[model samples]
Target: MGEQQIPDATDPASVEPEPQRGLSRRGLMGLALGAGAAGVALGAGGGVVGGIALGRDQAQAATDAVAPASGIHQPGITTPVQDHLHFAAYDMMARTTRDDLAELLADWTYAATRMMQGLDVSATGAVGGSPEAPPDDTGEALGLPASNLTITFGFGPSLFDSRFGLEGQRPAGLERLPAFLGDDLDPLRSDGDLCIQACADDPQVAVHAIRNLSRIAFGRATIRWSQLGFGRTSKTTSDQATPRNLFGYKDGTANILADDTAALDENVWVSASEGPAWLAGGSYLVARRIAMLIETWDRTRLAEQDRVVGRDKAKGAPLSGGDEFTAPDFAAVGSSGKPAIDARSHVRLAHPDNNGGIRILRRGYNFVDGTTDLGRLNAGLFFLSFQKSPDSFITLQRALSTDAMGEYLRHVGSGLWAVPPAPAAGASVGAGLLGA
Candidate 1:
């Protein structure tokens, strides 16, 4: 990403090609006119061919994208937010020993490294393995590119209670989140010993990573709950535009950017001086599956909706007036001579100015799990945030207890996990914590 041009997605060095190349006749034209492609794509004669060329460019960009498995911090938290997510929580199998937990991480790290590079899970992959037994790799991702895949691991509060001699090392603030005012949390969908967050530009690539990782953990652990999300709700870099939630409001308008090192240190990354040594440079992750009542929201008047969010529905600007990025003028008065932004509005309550300058990096997604029994769309924001300490999130959430926007939402699934820093290359994730 620094200076190198993206290599082709189908390059032999990056991916093991399948027996058949999945290309259409129009795709052949895109490959033929590769260099001066854009102008030709928009040409009068090239209608559908133009669409194919655009698709080609996106694929090429994804293939060239790769987040290293080893870094000062894990990749997904601060990586440019991918388009899709496959998040799963796992409970360790009964009678499993500490060694089993350590080995599971080692196996996951190895496979993640390969998949992130657009390679198979192992050298003897799906087709290359023996014909009798199940394949090492799930052959689904065979001809696909890496799609900027990242797999992040985290440990939950329940995992540290003397089960594996980790009780003494638990971070002071690492506990199950206290119940908030509007929580209708489902026990089945909440909490696990471990969590894996897999994100990628391609849905298939994201799903394949989780499927393969879960396969690797077959004996040691099993999935407790999982969620599939599309249309990322937050961005980790400045280049991305603010995305809208199901309520049709642009969310994460003030999210932390990947390049803000000072902000990262202050708000996102855990410091060794502030936490257990093994968790240094890592962050705490809070996952809340918030269900939005879009039908009810859709029927609400436009003016009422604007008042609830404290931003103009059309421009996403502060009610006090200015552009979308303008800092809110909480003190400004409306024509009626009242405070322009309502005190109970979501914006004013969640702002850093009002919360003693608190901020968290958000990398969430929008989810639709199909129709509920009542025949309403079961859809909402799969809210995910990373912070140095869980207290930052708790404080902000408590501040939003009276939020007018909370009326249209429900917190159905929740989990809090302490994300550890990326392991050294070729080392198991959480090795430092395990003292392995």
Candidate 2:
């Protein structure tokens, strides 16, 4: 959590560039221009180009917007939730060295700083560079505002392998998550060596961030799996309204708020006393690609739906409560002599009070990827949470294993990552661990 001066952005000494690839500068520029023209032409018939161009113009007309890229903690963790998200997991190539990994982080940090400020990745930018040279940035976001973009990076347990001589630097608590009941996890989408979370108010801005970063990692890393999400399902700040999930129920009604510093320190940030000095102020990220069985849930009666969630759908209030934020009277009796809120309801089972008083910062989003092979809608919540320790999540999930709501949900893809503290003003992410 110590502060240090960041290198001057104008000085090329701040970050080491990757070795040039086979494409000559002139050839790269020519190819890039050709691609740009083709994209414009493709958008011409639908008026897409005009629309986006207008959007860019409008964005530029406003005052420049920015999100601080450095602080005591990463921006995306506690920053107000954005409307769109682009989450990607990557695997480092076998031949990549420790130096390669360190340089990549530094380069990423520099680019992130510029992008967050509404500038291009490098001085050459998307256009106006040498006619033959490859453009430093993809031009899609050329006319867009910063849209409060924040890019957060994390290291998975797999990254601590012999390949990078980083085996000893792994945090003692970083490990593959334990399997839970009813977890139908797919190995292909389950784990990765590293991950990046790009969030912004504009969908295009979010996509562009991930696209450019992936391009930067060309030989050193390859994307394992990625997800695009919209309609944020949770709010990190008190000012934002709680968003709903695919189930049509308001989600994250009682989530941790950005202004709740005390709760955040206790539940989200790791202290130096926790050990692994490098992770101080850092947090653990848990992502679950949960697929909702809409058909089954749709067939159930409204009464049963309310019972399953232990809340009134229309009001999002506890069945035995006064309102949305009212404490659930778990012991209240119904007119029929049964417990008002069922003992196995999701709210009761997953409540922190029942799970050793642990809470997590939820930053999830809703997703829909067309239809499944069986003709059902392939839709669900991309559940994301950050916590001081993985055990907090582990304990809460174990209690939910037997919750009635589990019937309509399936855990397909999963990942756990160690999110390091934010870099100093001039430092790149992971600088502490990499000793860059």
Candidate 3:
């Protein structure tokens, strides 16, 4: 299949046009005064706050531009992993109609498009809006740059229930994942009716996206769980150096790359023949919040740590030798008369060779969320993977059930989502499903 084209965000035909030169301080002051007047008018009639229009050329020029939102596939997955992440899952409120859900998606798409370009959620934006009324935007990201923001949306199995009348359209591969060994899942954080992944170089920018989206979803949905991550744990492109996990070992050396289009099609995007036609160019997302036992791993001997991960700490090379990208010599034996790479080591068990040549695109991050009951640093890897089917992840994870790395980690949270293909110009994300 041909790759879908991603429209340019600066294209006037694709996005709402902003002032050529951007707004000045004087222009902003005048707008603020006008907004105050509008606020008074709104307060008299109990209406939404109104605001003056502002331009975004200044903000756009301040930050790096990201991949366009419209594409064959969504941006966050293969768009060079950002430094920060704000991932959220939501449950549809009871009694929400199909129209209500569709409208929410449209609103979200519009807001996301504007934010990705360094503009506020709406033209009036935060400070320009009525002072007496609630601002349309949350105002936290007022002066921040776009920071290469990208927001990707997905639908969960629960979304296809009678509430939306989409039961017949649910993909065959969309189903609740089977429980795996060592899973200590929290029901409150595990599953949801929908999900959004917002990534940016700046943490505040990413947080702003989710914050505003959740605000927009006030009555239609409620946040089930959310996670904040920093210091990306995986590399999605060849130019980027492999990042390390909380364990201090380099991660994703063997991960699929953005330039590997053939591998991506075979392992990531769903095809029309795969079952659901609407999901033709889409992929499935699997997220796991893994808690690493930092204290224990810190005390382990260096050699043992290397053996557990099956790679050299300094060079990230396989036990059997060669650089980081060299294919592991799993068949090679060591001086002790055993396989150089331990049979149960992470590399041996998770390698595609052992799992029928299955591969996944990993976009994970390191997360530190305060502390546990014992006052231990609550840190771990927020594992994120995208593939054509959840079966790919399930198959690999099951094989790793006996992996030595499991002892140092715990699967505390999990989710599975069907990320639809990117929308065409003038269409919203998931427009294929909503028929908008």
What are the per-residue Cα lDDT tens digits for candidate 2 across 1-436? 4544332222333323322212223223323443110000000011010011112222233324555433477779988999999999988777778877875676565555556656665556788688677776887898898898888889999999888877888888899999999899998878898888999999999998877777666656778889999999999888998788889898899999988999999999999888477788889999999999999999999999999999999999999978888988888999999999999999999888788889999999999999999999999999999999999999998999889999999999999999988775434577778776
| lDDT, residue 415, model 3 | 91
Please give the range of 10 consecutive residues that has the lowest summed lDDT in model 1: 38-47
Clashing residue pair totals per candidate (backbone < 3 A): 0, 5, 0
Name the top lDDT candidate: 3
Cα lDDT of model 1 by residue, 302-364, tens digit: 988998999997888999999889999999999988889988899999999999999999999
For each candidate, what TM-score against the reference? Answer: 0.85, 0.87, 0.89
Q: List the residue pairs that clash in candidate 2.
A: 6-426, 25-132, 25-133, 26-132, 29-133
RMSD of each: 11.6, 8.0, 7.2
Which number leads on TM-score?
Answer: 3
Candidates ranked, most accurate by TM-score first = 3, 2, 1
